[model samples]
Target chain A: MRVLALESATRTGSLALVDYVGAPLGAPLNGVRQAAPLREITLDASLQHSEKLMPALIEMLGAEFKIETIDLFAVDHGPGSFTGLRVGMALMKGFAFASRASEASGKPLIGVSSLEALAMNGSGLVVPMIDAHRGQVYTAVYEVGAALRDRRKSLWDGRPKLIEPEQAIEPEKWLKYLVEKYGSVPRLEDNQIHARNVAFLAALEFGRGAAATRPGACHRHAPTLFSMTPRYLRAGV
Target chain B: MFILGIETSCDETAAAVLTDQPLRILSNVIASQNEVHEPYGGIVPELASRRHMEKILPVIQEALDKAQIKLSDLEGIAVTVMPGLVGSLLVGLQVAKGMAATLGIPFVGVSHLEGHLQAPLLEHPEVSYPFMALLVSGGHTLLYHVKEFAKYELIGGTRDDAAGEAFDKVAKILGLGYPGGPLIDKLAHQGNPKAIKFPKGKIKDHPFDFSFSGLKTAVANYVKKIEGGITPSLLADLCASFQETVVDDLIGKTVLAAKEKGIKTIIVSGGVACNSRLRAKLPEAFFPSPLLCTDNAAMIAAVGYHSLKKGKTSPWSLNAMANQDVRFC
Candidate 1:
């Protein structure tokens, strides 16, 4: 299966196309394997995602791969810049809709949580923090087990266990609470949301049969082109 | 040529399909966020953007469905990209670009103001070039000398609040509902326009420029003075007087520009053009239907039809501008 993933939930947006082979249904959880993207482009922070996204995609899809050739579309939905999230989701929705129209079938669309995707950057007691502005950060704590780390060579092996549900809170208050609970907090890393991670995570989900098998079979748990929306944890003003 | 138009510049999530060669509107769909922003007494940018994200696709799909056309049938796409909330504009822009890229069709980024200017052409195709346009809406109040399609020379504009913004503010002050233009217009009919002689907005030296902040304040002060003794009759009178002043201000500047430019044709458009008092007063001028008057996609597609004919297409790098002037090229 081919997956075209987009990560535009932050200033630095990226796009990646990964080719993966899904494991047989009911196979072992870590059976799916993904190759590095056939093409990848990380956009410069100088331009907004709206300005750079299409141009980059056009260049990547130039004469080599048509949009329809990609089997599935993935995007990092929200918990980051509200506008960025919408731009990414809107573009993905457009592509997915076009794909569906051309094939006359359901084009599976996977939405990865921006915070959860960020957690994949680290292992073991991971706390991914995205600068939510307004002196607050969108964050969540996840416990990445050693078993998942051992199989990281393949697909993003296992879903991180949620230690704390995602939220928007002050960094100082969150850090103070973390110190009292775990003695020493995990290393804080800068936000580096990559589309490759989004693709890998979506590939894992597809292998686990989270996607629909037939046309118009999308349910609440599975997101379709029409059903995907940004996960803006913070309420609008 | 069949063109798809998308507009999410403000509280309205609108889409339409238009075809040229004897221009006609196949479908114009709009999903308004009035109820979402009604509690805030005004449009909150974040909320508007959020609502637009939720409704953009369904609205576009409806537009195509109502027109009985498929996405592949569209030859071009046009979307409002400037003079709007950045978050809201991005939602529409990205979708338009995505569809265009996927279909391998050309798309153009339209200015919101330009979309309003082309609205008259959808109905009054007889209204020729070199006409004067008075655009009055929640976001802007400006007069333009439209030499031709995509050729515009800005003449005058509001210095403080847009004419429709003033209406909304005054409506809020009067304890009226949101979108003050229609509310005040409906109430004004029951009361006498001569009941309260409100001061007309005037600018020094710049006779065509408008300043409605003074008028908004004056209405607020009057309502405060009569705080305890308010009645429906008094509220009607207040709405009537305020609407009269705005209509007068809009007409005064528009007429001045028309006379100075020797332009006989006047096109009135935008949200405030729905005001009955304005429509009743400016009977000679061309006014689009109430649906066309407000922010809708048909006008944008109309502009796109003309623009695409001229081989004017935007690059994929085109980005949304929160505050960009109308481009004549």
Candidate 2:
């Protein structure tokens, strides 16, 4: 199965295509958790996600891959740039819905938290932080080590969970929460989220069957074409 | 040929379907967010974009459904991609691009200003080219000498606040709430336009240029100086006076531009073109329907249809420009 993942929760938005080995009929395939990405393209959009994303993704896929080959669509939803998330979600929804005209059923859409995706960039206890403007950061804490004792258990089968929910808060408070959770804080440089990391985490989610669930745990939600909306945490007054 | 147009440049999430050979509009649906932003007394950009994200998909689907066409029937897709809120523009543009790609059809990014330019053509297909166009809207106020399709020369424009924006601001000063254009227009009918005299702003030696910031300030000062502090009666006079000043400047400058360019035919478009005063004053000029006067996608698709015929299609790399001069294209 192939998953087309989009990450536009920040200025630097990107899309990736990851292929997963389907489970055998009798027994689960039980492949390694972090499968290598097949193709990944990162966009240094500088807040130009809507204009640069579609063209970049089409060029990245080229003519070799058909649109039907995409079994799942994923996006790094919310807690980042509000416009960025909307553009990414709209593109994902459009692709998912339009492709349904030809296939037996529409492809599944997977939305992952940008903060959590950032934490997946490295091993060990991770506290991902994104500059959310207004002198605050959109931060979340995650324990992304190989928590599962069995290697056959997928990493995204809900093993590594979010230690703290994502929220926009002051730097001092964010640091305090991180310190309280994990004895000491990790380096600030390690918490940076990348588009490639978004693809990698989405691949884990797809392999774990979390993509098929209606509403999974760990801030992951599968959205239909009509019900999809960006996770705008800072939405009202 | 069938085309789909999506417009989210501002508060209106609009979508339309147009067929070719005569450029007939099959469907035009708009989901306006006026009520959502009414409490603020003006459009809030962030709030506007948020509403666009929520309504864009359903709006497009409804447009297709109303046209009695399926997604596969569309030969092309057009979206307003410039000269408005970037966040709002992105929502429509990205979706159009994705749909076009999925359907294996071509999609083009139409300029918002160009969409205004072509709006008259939708209703007045018999109208020819080489005419002066007065585009007055919340975000823009300009005069253009359009020689032909894709040939636009900007002659005059507002120096400060756009004409419609000034109306909105002045209306707020009188407690008229958000979108002062229609309300002020209604009240101006009851009160005498000559009740209070307001200065018409014009630059020295620049006959076609306009400045409404001073006029807006003058209204603000007058309202503050009134002995009773702006009663309903006083508000009516103020709306009438302010509307008169704006309408005179707009008509006066546009007439001068037309005469100077030696063009007899004039076209008025955009949101402010729906004003009763302008409509009554410029009977000769072609004005789009009241529905088309505000932002809509039918005009965008109309312009896109012609643009695509001319072999002009924006690539997927087309970025949304917030402040692009219409003449440069």
Per lDDT, the best of the predicted structures is 1
Q: What DockQ, between 0 and 1, does each candidate earn?
A: 0.69, 0.54
Q: Give me the TM-scores for chain A across all models, comma-separated.
A: 0.86, 0.83
Q: Which stretches of candidate 1 lie over 4 Å from their true place?
A: A21-30, A149-158, A179-183, A188-191, A210-220, B224-228, B326-329
Clash list (residue pairs), candidate 1: none
Q: Write the per-residue lDDT of candidate 2 for residues A4-60, one digit (tens) a residue.
A: 888888878777777665532112224444545688887788987866888789888
- TM-scores for all candidates: the values are 0.93, 0.91
Over all chains combined, what TM-score does candidate 2 have? 0.91
Interface RMSD, prediction 1? 1.1
Q: Pick out the ten consecutive residues of candidate 1 chain A with the lowest summed lDDT.
A: A210-219
Q: What is the lDDT of residue A189 in candidate 2?
A: 60
